[model samples]
Target: MSSSRAAVAGWALAACVYLLAQLHRTSLGVAGLLAEQRFGIDAGQLSLFVFLQIGVYAAMQIPTGVLVDRYGPRRVLVAAATIMGGAQLVFALVPLYPVALLARAALGFGDALTFVSVLRFAATHFSPRRYPVLVALTGMTGTVGNVAATLPLALLLRHVGWAPSFLGAGALSLVAGGAVALLLPDSTPPPRAVRTAAELRSGVLSIRGRVRRAWALPGTRLGFWTHFTSMSTGTALAVLWGTPYLVTAVGFSTAGAGAVLMVGVIAAAVVSPVLGWLIGERPSVRVPIGFGLSIVVVLGLVLLVTAFGDTPPAGPVVVFFVLAALGGPVSMAAFALARDYNHARSLGTASGVVNVGGFVATVLIALGIGWVLDLQGGTTARSLRWALLVAVAVQGFGVVRMIVWWLRVRATALHRQQRGEPVPVSVVRRRFDLRVTGPTGESGPGD
Candidate 1:
């Protein structure tokens, strides 16, 4: 096949995998209540299940980065998807709660591979300028997947029973896995020689050393940090807990909450690509990102207001909250930024590093917030209220972080220019490299 055709196929497969991964993530939102009733569990148990799922998922990011870099995304991704699908199958069949929780953990571990693979693929195949757009488009597809998880998934789970739903979703995951294995092309140049484990470790460490050089620059480091902090909080709230908040605190039913949350995700889907476009065209991510973060801050305040029963009358308040829900572009912007800023030497590693902040946030802050709610008498109303306040405070910290970073970057650039020092510049460029090797110890022109 031609290189262009191969790249297209790879991207298509990645999209499918991403869609399924997203479905797996959001599926739990609807299943939470059912799982609770079926197992006679409470909020703490549910939180623990989610905590375990995300914690394992988050911890696997770096390992996935390493594996993808070594073996290429094709094999690694297929293995993960298959594992995830099998786990889902077990979840569908298992009767015991403990077994189901273990299944969820396995599913999450497998699902974590999806995004890292997508990041690796984008860095290898797509042009740098186009990477942001592609990443945003990928996120938008995930939002579509989120939408599927909401109304369609809820309806399916209710009508077909959760077991059948899991089986069907598992089938979809396996198909996605097979498709990816068949489609994705390995781009990294084959090893010059079969190196020892120590050699591999040395090489990886060398890459990290170079990565630290890039991170030493204030603009790049600050950008990465701000992106991580914001998305960490946003994803924890929006992806994991938004439905519950709507269902319990806002007085929406499960199905209703699902539908409403889908709309919010749709809003995010529409805005993300636009933000990426703006960043590419305008040459400043801060404007769009800053605007989005402002929305999050506003949403936080609104939640705080609502908690105090000082919200505006019903009609406008719902609209306001829905608009607040639209603040997800900030989260999307963070993903785009991660794709945008990193040097190309070890793209997967850089992305993994950038993503770590958010993973920590989700694990620590998201889980901690749940624990806090449990302490606040373990009721949804009280927990949500407290969680909102915490989200507000956390988001406020993110905003301040971004603002400070922006100012520092600007001040440094001005200082450099005034001193007649060569200022670092930002521009997106294309890169293509071969992956396979020939018999005579030479690289094949793969791309």
Candidate 2:
């Protein structure tokens, strides 16, 4: 078989695991009420229960990145599939709420393993130029799984009853794991060389040292804040509270809420590639001072109104959904920023650090909403407005921190530019056009 074909086949299978991971990650959002009924829990307890999955996933990322680096992506992908499959089965069959929470935590652990593995797989197998596009597609695939967990999972639960629906989903994931174990090809190996003592020492650096070094970079911190601010609300909505809020607050039926969420996911998927292109190719289009903050602020204001105000008209609710969808893809910009500022050697650590912010923010947002709902006496329309306002307030704080870091990074970049060292093109946005020119004087790909 051609090497190219093997790469594609392997990615396709690993991507299935990622899809399952995302499906399970957001499964509680659709199943929140059902789980609540089955487990005999209040809205606040249910929120805490569901958000545990994401919390575990967020906390495990750096460790999981280490696993992928040491053990390789294929093995990690298989293990992730196996763990998630078992967790889902436990979630399906167990009548006890405590066991289900443990299952969700396991599912989150598995979910943490899958994304880093998929990224390592792509980085190993694909050419550099195609890597960014493939990464965008990977995110889009996860979005597809996220969309499925909404209406499709809801309909499945509706028709088949909760146990059969989740049981079947679990069974499918187990099968995917087996197929990956048996059929997936190993990543193409790079040429080996004798390692120097310094290289070996670097690889064994303590986790604290790795994180501290990465955190010291102003751009890395900017990336963290960007990820934190941009993705938390959208993710909280999709992964835990979005559907319930829509149904309880906006008078949408189960299917209607799912449909709206599904549309937003699809819209976000479509917009992702365009954003990826703008960042990778036409970066000069960015306004140096604020970068992507304008759209983020607009999305925040929309959420503020949607969450804090009295049951808004349907128009604003729909607008918030559309706008929040954009936030997911927008968070991808944070990774781009990490790539821009960090050395290639420290990129993985920086990326993992950046990755933590969004999910950490997500867990906090869900908790905030859940606690507020309890305070307001349940999940009524009036209660959700207050609940979501608490969540959005958390997001606003993240945005403020992002701006603070952005100013510092900008100042640092200017210092580097003044010293005549190479800096990321984004640092010079609107100050000067720095694209390379071809023979005919046309701008290069950096244009």
Candidate 3:
């Protein structure tokens, strides 16, 4: 196959691996009640499962990114698939709660590998112009897994029982691992010259400093807060608390809650391509677009908290969920921003750093909700409302951080332009007058 074909084939397999990762990540949401019954745990213990999983996932991000950069996606993705597959199977068969928690941690560690690797694959294989759409598509496809975790997994748990349903999911993951191992073509990194042993030791010692440098870049920091501000609310909802909140708090039936959560996932999936196209066409507006989306999300959260507090009627609640879901697509702009700001050598590291934002927020928000519920002594509508307020507060903080970073980056870009240095296309000033001529006395593309 041609290189382009090979890259496409490789990414297709990677996307499948990502699908399974998301499925494993969100599986607990639908299974919360079943988990509580089977493991004899309360809301706090149930939240611990996701908290531990996401914590491990968050902790593994930098290391996994380093591995992906050093080795490439094939090795990392294959290993991730195998570990997650095995972890899920163990989660299914194990009866002990402690053992189950270990399985979740393992799953989280494995899950961490899939997303950044898939992103690295896209970055390595595709043209820069194509990347925004590809990134959005990757996110959209992963939400299919989230949808599966909802109604389908719930139905399977109800009919086939927990062990068999999870065992089947695990088996599917193993098959996906095999496919990735066999079919995924690794990206070639720039060649490195042989170095002295002393030099190698010095390099190892400076790895932390190098990471710090990557974080210092304005674009990478922008990416981080972009992901931070845009993704956490929906992620916190979809991956752990949304279903329970709907059922236990808002009083939806199991199936009804699942359907509502499914709508949010589906809405995100549907909106992603449009956002991708818009970002591709007007890269300069990326931050503004993200800010707009964040505003919408904040509005939705405020409405949910103030208007729908305890007994939310379904229609307005669905609209609020859809608005929250739209944030996922908007967050894809962060990866594009990261790509523009960083070099290829550290792309994986930058991506890893950017990827951490949302999950970190999600972990804190999920755990906070659980803690609040525990303090309230049970899952009541009022307690759930209070828990959701935690999400609102966190999101509000993120929006402020995003705005601050965006201003800093924009100023830096302007300063660089003033010095006559080449900068990213997105930051260039556009001339609105169609008749305006460049120094060459001809209309430029910007005109």
Q: Which one is best on lDDT?
A: 3
- lDDT string for model 3 (212-259, tens) is 866887678888889988988888888888888889767788888888
CA-lDDT, candidates in order: 0.65, 0.74, 0.82
Q: Report the Cα lDDT for residue 362, model 3.
A: 84
Rank by TM-score, highest first. Answer: 3, 2, 1
Q: TM-score of the candidate numbered 2? A: 0.87
TM-score of each: 0.83, 0.87, 0.91
Q: Write the per-residue lDDT of candidate 1 for residues 173-292, one digit (tens) a residue.
A: 898888777767776665466469998788778766755754554444454556555565546654566666667766777788677767767887888788667755654554345546
**Model 3 off-target regions past 4 Å?**
1-3, 189-203, 426-447
> Model 3, poorest ten-residue lDDT window?
438-447
lDDT of 2 by residue, 1-447 (tens): 233887898888888888888888888777887888899998888887757888898888777766665567777788999899899999999999889889999998988888767766776677645655666677788888888888898888888888888887788788988998898776434434528987757666765677787777776787788888887877888887887888887878887888888888898789777766666565534223123543554455556555546566667777677777667777776766665565544555667788888899989989888998999898887888767666657777886797677656655555555556564453554444333222211111111
Of 1 and 2, the candidate ranking higher by TM-score: 2
Instruction: State which candidate has the highest TM-score.
Output: 3
Stretches > 4 Å off in candidate 1: 1-5, 190-197, 200-220, 286-288, 291-295, 298-329, 339-341, 415-447
Whole-structure CA lDDT of model 3: 0.82
Model 1, position 279, has a per-residue lDDT of 56
Per-residue lDDT of 360 in model 1: 56
